[model samples]
Target: MRTAICSGSFDPITLGHLDVIRRAAACFDKVWVCVSPNAEKKNQLFTPEQKLRLVQAAVADLPNVEAELFPGLLADYAVDHGANVIVRGVRNATDFDVEYQMAIINRGIHPQLETMLLPASAEYQHFSSSMVREMIRYHQPLEKYLPASIIPLVRDMTERKGE
Candidate 1:
């Protein structure tokens, strides 16, 4: 099977993330949406459990996609899952540069695994978890950026979490 791992912080899975995951599902026999913590993001909006739940809810419709909380090196997770590809989404030049560098580093760590960068669809190119979190903080509508399945969950959770 051509298994791939789509690793990301996914503090809150957005429409753009769902888009890339949907596409990745079409290409890989199996795709695991690995929810890893972002070391750079010290104050995450959602807890690890909440992030995993949101991701699971968002990707429920995709048969080949599954969400997991991976608290170790991505390369190690890939090996454990028997995944040979790392799927990523690139929205623009800046994103490409960063993802490309990370891809190189991941490749060095797991020589058997390769990274595949998928260009973000135009509608979701500008959407990001950070942007959605900011909007949610100010009580803004998120119908455009978040998956319909998780919109209500996000609102409820954010409110309960005191955001």
Candidate 2:
């Protein structure tokens, strides 16, 4: 079976992320959305467990999709998970540059693994987790950028920021 790893910090999974996961599901037998815990981002709104739960809830309908948390190198995690491919979503040129550099470095570490980039859907071309977080912080409606189910969670988190 062909398995692919979609690894990200997923501070809070947004619609753009769900879009990528849905698209990746169609192309791979199994698509694991691995949430990585970054030591550098300790102030992340969602804890690793919360991120995993959110991802699981978001993709629960997808039979071939699953979510999990992993710490350390993403390439190593992919190999350990038996994934031969890495799926990434690109929204623009800047994303391409960053993902491209990581892809090259990942390839150098694991030449057998391939990275596939899917262009973001037109509606979500400008959507990002950080943007969503910022919007929520400012009390801006995020109906367009986040799944309905996630809006409440994000709202609650952002509201707590002021307390």
Give the Cα-based TM-score of candidate 2 against the true structure. 0.90
Q: Which segments of model 2 are wrong by more than 4 Å?
A: 41-43, 156-163
Name the top TM-score candidate: 1
lDDT of 2: 0.86
Candidate 2: deviation at residue 126, Å?
Answer: 1.1
lDDT of 1 at 118: 95
Point to the candidate with the largest lDDT. Answer: 1
Q: Across residues 9-82, which tens digit of lDDT does each residue of candidate 2 receive?
A: 88788899999999999999999999998888655777788788778888989999999998889899899989
Give model 1's TM-score versus the native structure: 0.96
User: What are the root-mean-square deviations of the candidates from the true structure over C-alphas?
Assistant: 0.9, 1.8
Clashing pairs in 1: none
* Model 2: colliding residue pairs: none
Per-prediction tally of clashes: 0, 0
